[model samples]
Target: MSTLLLSQDQVKELFTMKDIVEICEKTFQGFGEGTVINPTKVNLDLGETAAFPPYKGFMNAMPAYIGWTDIAGIKWAGGNLGERKRLGLPYVTSLIMLIDPKVGNFIAVMDGAFITNMRTGAQTAVALKYIFNNGSSEKKPIKLGLYGAGMQGHTQTLAISELFDIEEVRVYDVMKAAAEKYKKDMKDVVKGEIVVCDTPKEAAKGDAIVCVTQSKDKFLLDKWVKPGTVIFPMGSYQECDDAMLMNADKIIVDHIGQCLHRGALAELSEQGKITEDDIFGTIGELAAGKLSVGDYSDGKIVCIPIGTGAMDIAVASIAYKKAKEKGIGGTYSFV
Candidate 1:
């Protein structure tokens, strides 16, 4: 048996934004057409930590199988903000495994931290392409508001900068220093103006807003957002308030079924604020041109992503293929 091993750096060297974009486009097309088998994510809760006051969360392991391709895999990742802070590390730690569909044998193991960030960013970009009228003649460039300055925020900003002709980006975070640092780091890559905002309300004034903060309580308000703006909520669990969701003209998700069950949208449904019927459709449906964004004169459009595993696998599969073609990763045989 032969196995391929790829390190995080190796995987990074092999994959690019363009590659991830193509992978996401294909995955979204398949998902829209009902040609993929992506199961719901499994959540594992971690008990209370005495070290950090009132800090509790869960670990998520998502398994998926993609049709029209010979790839199957699972993304095993865990996050605990309190414990991570104690250890001086980020909240989430992730890894991915690619399995041979025929024998169900492990073909490769790689770091999923990069895969998760990149795929999530790409998914948001795909949604933006379908949600906004890019070709329309508008004088001012599209404005962007971003919440959080963490990995998700950084990567999503990079992806959005690559895909959209953004004019300005306003960022807000509880930690003012972190937000400033994020702006400094992103200055090299982002062409638009990066302004740090004191509050979510200030950031929400942009034409488009992206929320990636991990806030148990609500942070966004409906009154701050302008009509015709687009919102992308990346914080999975409880990120936005009922008012924001209720006021949205169209609610788009990566997968309505999964989002309705355990994601940010689920929390809203549990409170009886919104139901499955409230959602307009999935991002895939929009990408495939099957569902339209419809009239936007009423209010803004919101795209909530639950984070799909098929995207991670598709990206990993592409990375593995490139590694083989370019003679990147070392191969070994066992008897």
Candidate 2:
């Protein structure tokens, strides 16, 4: 027996944003139905010195088993915002190891950064399918507000474009150049106007708002968020003000436990401002046909996705199979 090795570019080539969204939808549905085991990721914090001061980074071990796919995998995912950014590299880097369910042997290892970015965006798409569109195939014109014009921002735009007719996309980054780059790069990708905003407030005025920044402090204020907007904060630290949580008409998460551990609402959870009960429901539940967001259409909504290992596994498993069938990757024999 041998294990196949797939590179990041190879993995990216194996799936499109649409393919990823579909896979993530199935994964979430199965997760909500209790057909998947997604454990809380274990984080190993490397204090501020790992990067520049005030910007600590971490590595996490995320493991999961998708019963429907009959595959088990673990992703070694980590990032250092300051250090990597200083070197002009991606803030996050990851590798996934896939295991055969029956033999308990490692079968493949693949680059996980692409999977991570696409799956994270796909997660929001899945949530929108049920929460915003109510699981309908009909597309609506959407104006999207985005904070942090980075890779995730790009992917988020691509994923959302698959489901909605993007009427406009407003983007803001601390660096004006970054926002301009996003506009230039995405102008052709999104069949809509891509506006580079001068301020976060300007960017926050759309149908839906997405924050993918690495800010340790809050930049997205509650006042900036208009009513009838869905906010997706995908960073590890809190980007939105506590009022965004306290005043949101409904708060949905990919996983409740993960929401408490890290991501947008972790501090609020730690401070007892909100608890699991405060959450309306998980995206998985909504995707599973157990809950609906139709009642909250006119109100402000927030969906916090920490990104799950099952999603990584689902995409990775399929990539591995495709690699083997096409003889695309190098293999290391173990027998």
Candidate 3:
């Protein structure tokens, strides 16, 4: 069989946020029940070395075998720290490969950067589904708070809007221009007001706050986060400070193993401030009813979904299928 090759633009044409979220729910639910096969992601830090410069960024290899669809694949992605500074490129750049489980043949090649961002955003939506109301549904107008305005931030906003009726979006970025641009661009798409805030504290005052920055230092402080707020820290690390994790009443993660190794809660785990016991459970558990997503009505909660490979492949699988059905993407035979 010939393989399908999909570009970023083609994937975008075939991908739907609502469908992506639904597809993610099945994979995530299976993962919680120990049915889906998703190994802990591998990370390579290329810092301060002869082969690479220091503090730029590293690469990650995330592979998964999603049972529901019977597709196995891996996402080979990396961050080029110098590109943003010297070449005006985003730190992240990557692609994904989808294989046919029946024949063990490589079946597709697709741009992973967009897939990654969309899945990451969908995870946040999925987390909110489980954590927002104990696996129930919410219909109230959402007051959204944001900490970053880059590509990830934009996609997160897009995904959340698909799930909730966001009446207002309060955002803050270190670069004022980025924040302004995010608002200007979102105005036409966002039904509600997109307000720019001067500080992270101002941005954190929403019912649902999402932090999707490349921050190496913690910018969000606990003093700004009020009770009954649900925080989604999407950055790999150090977007929400230690105080939030320490003070949160309940903590939910997409994958406990992955989050412990890196991402929002890794530093907190390393510092001994937060432990495995403190974690409530994976978002999937909450969705699958295996673990309790008790009411956070009177308490503060945090969800850190450190981007799982299963979700990545799940979305890619959808793109591949849709592209095939719609006669999209290029065809190649390497057999």
Which candidate tops TM-score?
Answer: 2
lDDT values, one for every candidate = 0.79, 0.87, 0.83
Candidate 2 Cα errors over 4 Å, as ranges = 48-55
The local lDDT score (0 to 100) that residue 135 gets in candidate 3 is: 65
RMSD to truth, every model? 2.9, 1.9, 2.0
- Residue range 119-231, candidate 1, lDDT tens digits: 88788877777777532323235678899988888888777666667688899999999899999989876677899999778888677788887776678888888898888
How well does candidate 2 match the true structure in TM-score terms? 0.95
Location of the lowest summed lDDT over 10 successive residues in candidate 2: 47-56
Error of 2 at 174 (Å): 0.4
lDDT of 2: 0.87
TM-score for all models, in order of appearance: 0.91, 0.95, 0.93
Q: Rank the candidates by TM-score, best first.
A: 2, 3, 1
| Candidate 3 error regions (>4 Å) | 48-55
Per-candidate clashes come to 0, 0, 1
